[model samples]
Target: MRSVPEWAQQRGFGIRVEWGRAGAVAIGAGAAGVVVIDVLSFTTSVSVATAAGTAVFPYRWRDGTARSFAAERGAALAVGRREVSVAQPWSLSPAAIRRAPFTERLVLPSPNGSAIAASVEGTPVVAACLRNYSAVADWLLQQGWGTPARPIAIVAAGEQWPGTETVRPALEDWLGAGALAAALLDRGIDTPSPEAYSAASTFTALPDTPGLLRTSASGRELISGGFPDDVDLAVDLDADNTVPVLENGAFTDHGR
Candidate 1:
């Protein structure tokens, strides 16, 4: 399990990392702010779609409910698969959303992405990957997400399936979370854990890597499945820093 106290102290924001299903629920229930990391593609696409001001209705079904719903409303859909490459510097524009009706939804079917979206039902949801780390940090600071009472929690969408070995924690997600914690600490917060510092320090040590896709489990899986280019796409930092907000059944760009 990721360390929550270290993040809380380091960022001066109340940040925690939960390891199990119950922890996911606790964070989602507004116990703290949540950041779900599914680096493979699902969360990334949701972030892009939401940042573009589109409503993202993430369904767990493989039968095409999300696609059909989006088609019914005329929304452009981005289909997600474990083997597809994550598009670089991707963005969904507000104009595109305007072209589609309410029935249209972006159907993102991934092992981790959709699950994270579904977890955070009523809290402020933002997509975090190596690509938008700094942008996300700056945006979070601007929004006071690291304030004392408002804690930030990162949810890593580990491999969830029958017969799959336990998904080891990815280095990038921890580092990304650490960087976020460090940024928060820079704003006069109180993060004191060595682990948090270590994670943030690791990210700073290697600033050249664009995003987490190159060094994450999800990214590796996609590559093995045939999308090697996606690793680079998901790691570009600050390429687009639009903060995605979940409302009703979709995500909207909350950036100014």
Candidate 2:
């Protein structure tokens, strides 16, 4: 664990990868932009929804207040995978969110990705997935974010088990973040931290990303939950150019 100043002094750009809420808070303050990657579903869903011209509001938890929160914002609440149907237009299932009727805004609550995104404050936050890492990397470079003065933090929103206080690092999210880091490294930013380098290397080494995601722990869980289509949607590399950036308590398409 290197200190922040050390990172700033050693590299023109600090490309650090973190695990969950604690990781988000640790690196978020100094980051010019924070890319939250929840490859299993959360960020993937946001990317799909925003690309289809919808705004997404991220909520930390799916509880009793989620419905009112969505209603107050004039947005629909995205239900869990089990609750999804034609009547429930939005859900954590990326496939469902992609095919649902167009919505101007939707409130998506998740115990993992959405929680981490909402936990980050005062930093420009963006959602990234394997499907749109290229676009995200391009957009970050265009904003001059990877330079030393303006570093970027790529946070992998790993899953959490109920009643657990620690983060459960998900392989899919790690690969997703690694893909974005690899994109940045390829674009001429070469100061990623050791952990970041490892992640990038892992992604680059994977010959078949979608195939691996389909068999990962998170992927297997989603498959058992009857949301295998969500995993399929998540692995579509460079599928869209839309970047869902958090702004004014909502995520809207930043780079379209």
Q: Quick one: best TM-score, which candidate?
A: 2
- Predicted candidate 2, C-alpha RMSD: 2.6
> Model 2, 95-127: lDDT tens per residue?
998778998999999988899888887889999
Report the C-alpha lDDT of model 1 over 1-256, residue by residue, as the tens digit: 3443433333343555543234456454443457666544555555555554556665555446755865775554544332223331122222222233433246544445455666565676666655556666677667676544776665655555446635556655665566665665666656424544565566667755444446456566756756665555556555666666556656566666
Where does candidate 1 stray beyond 4 Å?
1-13, 19-21, 27-32, 50-53, 67-77, 80-105, 165-167, 192-198, 206-218
Worst 10 residues of 2 by lDDT: 1-10
Q: Model 2 lDDT vs. the true structure?
A: 0.87
- The backbone clash count of each candidate, in order, is 15, 1
Candidate 2's C-alpha runs over 4 A off are 1-13
